[model samples]
Target chain A: SVAEQLTPVLRESKFKESGRITPEEFVAAGDHLIFISPTWQWMTGDEAKIKSYLPRDKQFLVTKNVPCLRRCKQMEFTGVEKIVEDVEGEDGWVTHETDDMNLNECAEEMTLDSSKMDDIEPKNEDEDDDDQEALDMEEFDVDNVDPSVAIIKPTPIATTKDSETDSVIHTRTYDLHIVYNKYYQTPHLFLIGYDENRQVLNIDQMYEDVSQDNAKKTVTYEAHPHLGPSMLAVHPCKHSDLMKKFLQIAEEGGNELSVYSYLIIFLKFVQSVIPTVNYDFSQTIKTT
Target chain B: MSEKKVFQYVQFKSLVHHDFWHKLSDIKLDIEKLNESDKTIFGTFTNLNAKNCLLELDCTSFNSNFKTAKNNFYCKGTLKNLNTIESFKNFNRNELLKKEGENLLRIIENGSACKNPSELISFIVLTYADLKKYNFHYSFAFTASIEPLIYEVSPSQNITDEFSENDIENFSSSYHLLDQQQAAFFIATKHLDIILLQNALDVNQRDMNLKDHNLDSTYFCFSDPSEFPYAAWILRNFILLLVKLCPILHGKSIKILSVRRDEKSSLLLSKLFFIQLPNKIDLDPINMKWTGWERNDQGKLLPKLANMSNSMDPIKIAEHFS
Candidate 1:
């Protein structure tokens, strides 16, 4: 299974380590394969080498900051560009944003309700050694428990100049937005789930509102503040299935699957959920 | 946003060589000391733009003239005693000659190897001519120091000719010259832009590299690799700015990893690779080589991390998009 997950990355690279395979063995391993870098240093490479191997439409979910050269004609690859160097604290911020629901509800629904949906659980968490050990040793049941409720803190809400409701939490049909201070030290995602009366609902209450005895699914994402919220939304018509799977995973505390490495994870997740989400280079301008 | 500074210098040698004594005018300078601000650190009154450039002048008179020449042309009273800038610095005579000598050798090596090296010969010749003017005062000068052949710009006397076998023979017979080397760190009043690199992906060709990744954000610095200690300081400030701006990106969600590559071998050392992945607590783990985490002598985690030392729970953090 690890090998399967690693196939994609390996397919995109020509291994140079002694124990690693030669180019021929890699070719035989073949296309559209999944791969995982054992550590972040693997991403560091000369520009020509990285350009030659990385796929045009594939995913590159780097969890670390390492220099890489992309877009080399000598490498026989195209559409490779160093979009950005993600220096964790120096460059930018990627904050997780939650809805009214909590982690327990998410985990329970993901595992217990998997029979109802045909989506694959996010594999990122599976690579975590500690999580694998935890899953192996502990069996948590989410049916009887309720997530915790906290004291409601009121804060000013930012809105457009034309809008009238200034400090109130607006109840929309689809999503909930929580106000986080700019100086907040943690990137934790927070959301205030509310009822029709604009009252905040705690975790157990949110679970009951969804009211599916069987597993329900949903897709959750951390808001990449720089990209705006539109990138967080599921494709049109593709939300139903994704929502079902996402909800199930979240109900079971499946936070691991939803955490992302780079923007590519979201793109891959998007393409996987909605096949119509184009990964075509024809639509992408060659900036390099 | 602090006030920026610009560096400007006047070449006294230029004015003296150009026969522009009458044209010389007073210049004022508002030069300040490094730390002390209250007392007038250094000021000048008289200008020497018209005076026959005195090769040697007392520190006080030179300081006064410096102030008159240019309000900003004053040094820290260090260079007033000597006509040449090299006289101000307390460098060992041998060391100065050695460094400058090495510089001359580097020039020769570069000139011999590079194409269109006419400028190299011109620079050397100009420097030699300047030193020749002071030859009478320094009797210890060696015969090898200023060989006639070294000064010979043959035929039309232009020093721009490509090196021939005969030129090599002439150079072997030519003597060497001594000059002081330049300083290591030269801080001028030039404005510089610093770009912060985040992911280290191929960015040389991208207009939207850092700016695209994070909406157009203003960065305080982009350090040059040549500036070592200063570069490190700049990097530290850049990190401090990010922490002040967005502290959430400090911990577990993102990790900062660095590896030093051997310039000659290209070998990557594993232990040299430092990674600061977010632990349970949101703060980044400090794993600097000499100093590990900021902890007490008890070998315990620092006070800030004591509560969350074992908090790195294996909570599923990423989603698998099928």
Candidate 2:
């Protein structure tokens, strides 16, 4: 136990700063820093700024949900091929199995809230084709929205009796994110499961394959490992080893001096749920 | 060094709760019945101040983990002098095996012995308030007794063989006291005055239905006189004397300091947890430097350094307090 407590001191031999460091700050500071942010919101403006600010010599490690940083190039590791296909045979997700039904309905609710926007369209007469594509991406077509969007919906808490205290306790669910590493290949998406007390129950690899719709060119359905072959699949890239190592080091339980572990867990959970397209982090680095 | 006084000890004082108004009325009636010759002996009335006295309360919580054998009173010589595994194995292994093995086996089978799961956890609450002309100083301490139920499919028949009423009474009182001593050390070290101890068993019963208050109860001691010589007298007398000799140190304090084994002291953090009382009493309040003291081989402050010192009178150490 004492040896375990000394890990923060061991990790500090390589760094100048001491005490606790946040997940975002850690990713920005260290070389070979891995980013496992699953929330697409991280892909927008803030991440772009961080990408620009990162040192050129430093390697940017990404697991999932990476937006195209125009500056950095992806580093696709040799060996495995990246494929997007719908994995077959499982009844992906049922409405009953949905953790939160309200979250599942959020896209419809958002579209209803923005129905007024439809009336004010075409204000820019000189809009280019690229501008149209961007606007289309932002629009919420509830019917066409991915079923996986339901995963983010907030659920009402439920209470259960604790045999220990003989008291009814409302169990809280924790969001876990992980990046699975397999050495030379890209890191795979990992999901964490916890029992009632928030102790980690399981860690599993999540892979997603993609398939096309009637349009042929527009890839629609992706096969997720957990949900099987479905319209929404989570893809695992080959170069996710770096991200996995980062998570492993964080979870090894030495210095709880950072909240980066919690952040990484949350990120990987999101990645396992949502598939990002041909976004190879290693390739992004080489191009940069 | 100040001379330590051999103070007289008194015990079993009655904490009288009297209705003064009723007493005054009775005295007036007595005065009217007095004869003319007895007129000189007149009843008098005066306002009296209530005295705030030292109070001690004792409580016990049950931890199943601390359970010993039913008939075993004294610990084995081997268990008592245990240091290493080799020494432990050489001791009476049979006794240890019977108790430890049975407990472990019970857990494997699930706690079928007790119907109520709530009996596994319990709490004892005690409150002590000092009466004073001004604000009274209140202190509280709590000890938790954890008793894990050992479950076994085939439990010993001796367990189910209910003890006779007298045997139950004897074991409950004496055995409970023996069990409570470990918790008492924790409480004393914490310097907590008012304690609430809870056990896994919910023993709440209707007061009206109860006959003897002591039955099915842990001991409760309030306004205990015995503690004066043991605890309160030493603290009060030493503090008062220390203040009298050094008037400027009146605002200084002596607090209970708790140090865990592996705690580290740092510039940004202090390893001590200090709970300040109503006021602080400074004794040797000024930390002065001493020239003589020997460090042990382990670099620890030697316990007998002052006794082994060569100096006739040690100088005041560095005044870190003042």
Candidate 3:
């Protein structure tokens, strides 16, 4: 039933984007149901709007108008109080007697004013007074409570720093992009690193991460039309062999690494080369 | 330095599903039945166990024109020292096979079996023949483990005065010869792509005549008249060879013409090299018929042609050049 009421609002593009339903929107639907109910004459305009939102199949019996009020009073009070208590407990706002006191006070107010409310205008004013009283009570409670007592305690901060930095070996994270060079008919790895500031890392920064032998043997300074002039690419002649070795290492490590997502596995293998740098795809960068 | 003798053993791991030991016993029973009914097929079985079994075929005793006549094959092995099925659950079948193979190689190299042995342990060669044909042809499958005698060549014993870097590159590139034994292991384990590359290199050396080629391009067509089960091997090998030897052909645009293509073979080709099937063209080369088609920028092969003819027509191959 709640889903049925919310579906139209949820389908709205703006609501979908924001991923929320405002209280006013929820109340508006409730108002529509109240306006269509059989007890419209007994309700004020505001009450009618609220009651009209209730389902048409259920008959709304005004509590005082019921013939057997004496029998239903105890049952009604217990059920309503239980629901309110459960909701208050979940919200962590269970003041010792606030909800029970409010319910009794509202009931006393309703009984004292029942004989005075014959016309719609007076009934509307009485409903406004009740709402104002509830709002005032909430404000009074907030003002009276101590700030320290009212505030929820924050979670304890994690004591552990990046364990990698303290270890003998230092590690870094890099972004690996494996582009299929149609001309070479081979996969080419485009590696970039992140600085401490998380910007596109310089070639000089990456040089420190790689071994001196591998830096000389495999790394080549090449102008990538998209990545720019400083981009370092793995030498094409050794690309296939290097890939085979990377795959072999991955296989030995117990990763199935399918032919389709070999690029992800390639990035994983390159993690060993950089050791410290986390290797991830470019798409992940855009999302984060 | 002295020449050192190395001893190695090829270990087979048990198949987790479908009892391998039971299957071998069944085969042993079939061999006995064949020996009773057929005079041509003679087999001897020994050391049969849950972990080990030996099957020896005496083809020399039978009179035949088959190549098996010259080769007396011995396949005596056991599937022991294996990881349990629980451990296997974490690994892909290919990865497990490869790990097992490497482990077996390690055991052969340094295990107690190699220390102070009575006699030298040599590598065994296995030959499988298709007996359905009148004259059966045998294919050699090599195991990964090998026992080779190492020779000592001192640095001071330099035969050549000097050699260029290009000379060294060429020497090293051709030196290892792509270890057919390792290639065979890959094939037996269904490592299709590696086998494709190795077989392609082998086919390229045997089929292509590089002597007359000052030309920009050349085509090598392989055809076998017999119902070869591994006919697709040629096409796979050729495709890989093109990528390895002449990557520039990717830009030049190579086309594969096939008369009939099946989904499984097409999917395999697509997975190995992300090439999709192309639109059909009306150009029909003389003596060659095109059925199913897939064209790519790298290169293509007419898989159906391998099955259609005993040898590819040179004139038809020239049509691509034109």
Candidate 4:
């Protein structure tokens, strides 16, 4: 990309030095993202718009109908206001305040953020381990053990007994996509929302879910150059800058980052824009 | 601002066999000798889990007895071969298509389509054959005179959701009911009793029984030609016929079945919709301007030409021409 050649940070782009990614790195990172989160699938947008730089099937990534059950304003009732810095008149994302929480929300955010890595793995992998444990228990004649010797199968307490009736189920869903912008040389995030009946949500209606402060400044409706209709996009102009800050923080904490983990980190920071959308984007940036 | 929910209709395209041109040449040379007049032609199409609606025509389509010639699923239509290219170009297409719609209205009004159910779906074809050059200019219109029809598409999908795979299998039908294909727009009674619309005694009795059926059950359905998001073009005429059959059904919702098949697996991909026709049909001809003329490859509103000079015998044709 011209931007990759001209930009000062990308001209000397080492993982810790800059956030900008090359086209080849983006495709490799995309494969890693799809492996960790199966919900994120590859799509070759429009046939005419397929990029020669990328493979046919790996044009972009999409996770459809990620449920956004509450308005951002509703979440602000409990969430701490973390102000996102203004970027040069650009497009980008907003974040969701924690929706489902325990009595305390600050602690809930920390637990939820840290726990997501383990929560989003394919269940089939764990199921086999569980089956092997059961077989070992049978060989040990565990079923014949006395009540005192046996491990008690304690039942989990309900989060709410009569909660569903009171809370209104919002039928709004968002289709999230990760598109590679050659100019910005970054994976630009785009979102289009729909109501209950699958009718597309207009700009004004879609704004209801976006964090009120960022929606006007960072978010803008841009038609996907190669895919479906126009969608609310977070300006990619500031993405590299934000990534540099994240890498600086990681470096200060004595940790190094891999290019394969770029999209996961990208999604984690992007949560600051579309915070309400419940897509399975990684909660915490991981390093290996 | 909220975007309006625009419903798209599934459409049919023409499939002309090579022999159909040969038959037209024979008729032009001997039978039609510059006498430009309309003639009846049968178009056969099968909706057996099909994604595209193919309105097919062959040499046998020119036969007068082709309607009852054992090929069951067919659409009744008219063919007009203009003598000159200028005449074909200058011809008032709106007038011809409106006339066809007027004929359909007359049949619906006279209670003929109700009894026979075969005249419900119809089409018209126009062509200008340059016999000496062996090139052809042709166009088609499957007209549905939607004059006073105000259709309301329901946001609620209760009827469509309830109408299941078993119901679709039972509504197993062909193009022409007169050919003995089991067709009903299948009904889902309050008690879940599925009945074929054809087997029902009369419109009055069905209306009487379904007077309050708007509460629990869906009434009136037809095999749709569209694999589009909404109902197809043929359903427009079918709905008009239903409104004519039972006038009480005005302002009432009618269920539709758009059955399609998977190209690879051949599995049925049928969808149901409940559309409400609010206004009563005006006995007068539809005065509304229509625009369903098939477009070119680039989606422009222009006529296409097929030059067959390459496929002809050069020496014999050159001698004959000279």
Best-performing candidate as measured by TM-score: 4
Worst 10 residues of 4 chain B by lDDT: B175-184
DockQ (C-alpha based) per candidate is 0.00, 0.01, 0.00, 0.01
- Which digits, one per residue and each the tens of the lDDT, describe model 1 over residues A4-50? 23443233222211112222232222221112221111111112112
Question: Per-residue alpha-carbon lDDT of model 2 for A45-126, expressed as tens digits?
Answer: 1111122222322212322222211100011111122232222332221111112343334323323333322322221211
Expressed as tens digits, the lDDT of each residue in B176-279 for candidate 3 is 23331221111101111122223323323433422333212222222111111112211332233233233233323322211111111111111011121112
Candidate 4 lDDT, A1-288, residue by residue in tens = 445445443333454555788777887888888667655666555454567777776778866557765556555656666555434334334444464452134323423343322321221112123322332212212112211111212122112122323211234677788888777878899887765433345566677778787775667766565443356888787888888777777778988787888899888877777767767654456765
* TM-score of the second chain of model 4 compared to its true counterpart: 0.78
TM-score, model 2, chain B versus true chain B: 0.14
Which candidate order results from sorting by TM-score in descending order? 4, 2, 3, 1
Docking class of 2: incorrect
Candidate 4 residue-wise lDDT at B283 = 49
True contacts kept of 4: 0.00
In the range A1-288, model 3's lDDT, one tens digit per residue, is 243344332322222222122233323422332233211111111111122333221211110010111111222233232111221134211111123354344433433343322221110112223322232212212212211111112222111122333211111234343333323324445554432212233444455545333453455544332222234455444334444554455557765433334333334334333332322222211100
Candidate 4, residue B192: the lDDT equals 39
Q: Model 1 - which docking category?
A: incorrect
Assess the local accuracy of residue A78 in candidate 4 as a C-alpha lDDT between 0 and 100. 65
Angstrom error at residue A230, model 2: 28
Question: What's the ranking of the predictions by lDDT, best on top?
Answer: 4, 3, 2, 1
Q: Model 4: per-residue lDDT, tens digit, B1-322?
A: 1342333354565655444665677778888888888989877654443333556665556766443212225667889999987777667776787688778877766656665565667787788887777766666777764333444366524333765656544443322232433331344454335455444435545465445556336544555444445555666666666666666667666665554433221225556565666555564454443334443323333444444332233543344224
